[model samples]
Target: MTGTASVADMDQLGADVARPTLRGLGARWRQRRTAAAQLRHLTTYAGRPLVALTTTVHLLAGAAPVVFMIGTGAALQHLDDGGAMPWLALAIGAFLGQQLLAPVQLVLSKAVARRVDAACLTRFTAFALQRAELATLERPEVADRLAQADEAFEQWTLTPGAAVEGGLALVARYTQLVGAVVVLGVVAGPWVALAGAVVALVARAGQTEAFFRWGQLIRGFQPLRRRATYVRELATSTRAAKEIRTLGLVDWLDERYAAENRAVLDPLWRWRRRVYGVPFLTYAAVALAGSVAGLVAMARSAEAGQVGAAAVAVQGLVLCARFGVMFPESDVKLVYGRSAWEALLEFEAQAQHDAGPQAAPTEGRITPAQAITAREVRFGYRPDRPVLDGLDLDLPVGTSTALVGVNGAGKTTLVKLLTGLYRPDGGTVAVDGVDLRDLDAHAWQRAFAITFQDYLRYEMPLRENVAMGAIEHRDDDDGIAAEVRRVGLGDLLDGLPLGLDTPLTRALPGGRDLSGGQWQRLALARSLFAVRHGASVLVLDEPTAQLDARGEAEFYDQFLDLTRGVTSLVISHRFSSVRRADRIVVLDGGRVTESGSHDELVDLGGTYARMFEVQARRFGGTDGSSTGAGDDEMRTVQA
Candidate 1:
């Protein structure tokens, strides 16, 4: 028997499964590497005009610094030489370098961000699209990484990426710092060493706080922001709106969401305050040192009759110290940003690469054959409890087989195993005699057409829903019109504003919706469309539960005619609906416990026999009772 997997377990498992995927704990180091690689990758323009253009812009920006530095020195020299024109011209050029570089830098950053954002999303979505089911998505560790990407992927490149901002900020500050050193040497040589020492010390302190803040935001603080986003979705999204209003949950949800968001922000905000405070204190320290150096330089140069040069030198040193203090702070922020980007890249790599446990092969298709078989299958969602205890069953190809079972008897799991939707914990599930795991997944999936018990009613055109069953060839296939007619949905299709193309959703304007039975017909049509397009295996998994008695009888009676050359596996909880199958097998606790024709089972008085007898009493005679199933006739019980 299966161990009860709790609601919490199922929901939390996805995040747990995802946690160790990008296994290394060195997220900081990894982020720096990923950030560098991404920037390098984006900047790598091939041998062409584009590369030349990129180089040209950067070269011009670099040249501006030299021009400005020279201009500043020249202006100071001219003022000392008592030449007004030289001082005015050099001073104007100095300011021009400072002004022109700002806007050009902004444009380049914006352009690079756009490309990087697009590239990251395209790569991650490609990885996610390869997953076979939502089961893996349930793991929260993976969900967290996935959520990080979902939350920050676009921002990594599109938004003011910490890396880009930090990188540019560092470069700008460093350039100014170097220029200040040169100007100070020319103006106040005595105080140059003192200014450099003070600026470096302030920069080191800012870097330390930045490192701590990055980790805090990425792990401890980020989840609260994600929780807030979920709250917003619940409060306003269309699906949640009705529930929000009906249960009087609007204010409660709003408050909860607000609380969760604040929980995340409060720590970050406090940390930010601390960060700013430390900088302010450090900035004051740098200023105090600058002031002492300035006073000494001023007294000495004035006494030596060089006040103008001394003033320029002191001002230049002050500017360098300020820019230097900014350098390490920016570096830490950039590295933190890089960490977020690396997380996204690591998750993408794992999702795309983890195919070892799946059913698909790296080779050819599994042979199409005359039977499906499960040999000694033992299975469970988790390893601790056994859901299927060495179960075995076989269904001949080119014939219809029915599986009947009570709830928790493992009917649905059996269907998933048979369809290659899941792998057995022990033994193998086989199609046409070859084990399902050995077959290529793409081909294996293409071989079967299934109408699940919970089949989707997609909000698309009627024809598109049917065509989805035969996805690849849907564009050129017009014979779906005939299948629509066969299912008696022809009127529904024709009566719509647009034949076959009418949107089957109540949410859309002038669109129509389907009742339970009508949608079953559409699902049936989807199955037929699959069969028409070369699917040999057809599976009906209790989706016909909504069908009236006559509708079901018509389906069973014309079963072979409808299926023709297909291999059909039918699942029904009600034995009467499935009694006509060539064989009926009873599943209990995930194993095939009984097998025989319906009449034979009834005589044997097994699970199938008891279920048959229960429904048979409803008809008032012998076989089973279902409205308009037949007039005093029972479906055959084959042996």
Candidate 2:
């Protein structure tokens, strides 16, 4: 499937997918998460040196401003006390620190931003690749999430940012507060100091709640922003661009783009007004009460004639503590900042699955009743609209089974259930005679290789695009090159500037585009490469849709040869291509209508026969020229 079709499919994938109800806030506070996780992720992908240097620069630069703030505040207080002329020089030092910080922060921020952006892109993709086969990515919900990916303000990456910045600010600001307290205590009693700290926290928390809402509102609008972005990119993309102009579809798409844009963002603006207006009003009321309480305390002291220059110390300390006491606001901001992944954090769901190697059974891994079988399967993407019902299917040892269906007949859904992307609501999908639910999703997913009709054309180096087939072998350069050759793409890449090293995307410099047929060939090569790397079963779901007539014929002719030793389930709509399979199964209204050899189906005059007859009529429709199966050759197969 092209990107456009993929987007459409994903948007429509509403009920069929087995998505868990989103719940819970992160139990482990954001402050408690390892700063090392993001750092380690970046270091591993982009190299330790870059990660270290960038982190060092970022931490130091980010901390410098707060250091300047506290240091300057201390220097000012020292100057105000008329303590020493030498302190004026120290004040200039703090001014110099402030002067030096801004530009340095800009540079480090840029460096860290680039590194984290690239690193997250690489690592999350690698993470997904570890468990995500074609069937997983083929799910519409997964595509929606992937398309929604952005670099603006990832909550995970920000853990390190918050740690470095928040920690430093707290330390530096607290030092300023402590210095002020010492000088004030020498003049005034400790009661003034205590009251100031209390009020400062209340003030900071109030302000932080107001500021944090603005942040959430802004970030929450992004999914819609992405939906708009998806349209713009799809319109310009290589595949969809052709159809967009030819079908005069730019306006239709632009409207959907505008609609989703409005829908996603409309909430942000509405919530922004409420979050900003109410919080500020509430904080203003709170701030008024706090100021009155402080004033009343001072007024009583003044009435008692206990006020003196020491009063100066009490008032100055309050101001100083208020400036420094923005700590709890930072904490509150931190919590609200990750509203989305709050569940992951609160749940402390950190230990990742260790994907043990999937053990392929000795008997071609298909005991008929053994591996990856669906029994009494029932599913629906929507209420009262069951797609697949009572479907009992099993693959015996060492065989190729092809699923033939018209559009929306649940061919893709079957693949998802078998591959463990979606779970059946009513029945079970079993692998190695164990229900998939009983097996680890990660390990179970790791066992199969699948190429969807909508397989990705990665905008990476030519070799890396092929390497995605079985990513464990990504470092195996020889294997990557061999797969490139095996897929008949050697000639295609040979003439490029750097062969397999040449970027497969024309969007970049020194990059190139692949024709539809070539991309299909590359996707096929990827699935085959996985087989070579020990994928027990191969699934090709409408894998020939990108191919032209000739490429389809060539692919069909080589299909059995390509999958000779592997158990295969090929889902296709084209009857001619699937007829040679050991068994051909037809689905109608989401139930298996027929299953047999082509000859048996043709003789039965059932659903398969009706479909075959309908397709056969395409041979000489309107015009007298025949373009379908040859008369005797077709008859022999049908017989």
Candidate with best TM-score: 1
Residue 423, candidate 1: how far off, in angstroms? 3.0
**Poorest 10 consecutive residues by lDDT, candidate 2:** 15-24
Clash number for model 2?
A: 11
lDDT per residue as tens, model 1, 402-422: 887665667788888887666
User: What TM-score does model 2 achieve against the real structure?
Assistant: 0.68
lDDT, candidate 2, 11-92, per-residue tens: 3332112121232123222423543253333335435664456445445543443344444444455554675345445546
The whole-model lDDT of each prediction reads 0.64, 0.59
Which residue pairs of candidate 1 clash? 13-139, 14-138, 14-139, 14-140, 15-139, 15-140, 15-141, 16-140, 16-141, 18-142
lDDT of 2: 0.59
Off by over 4 Å in 1: 1-73, 76-111, 131-135, 153-212, 221-228, 266-337, 345-354, 357-367, 500-520, 546-558, 616-639
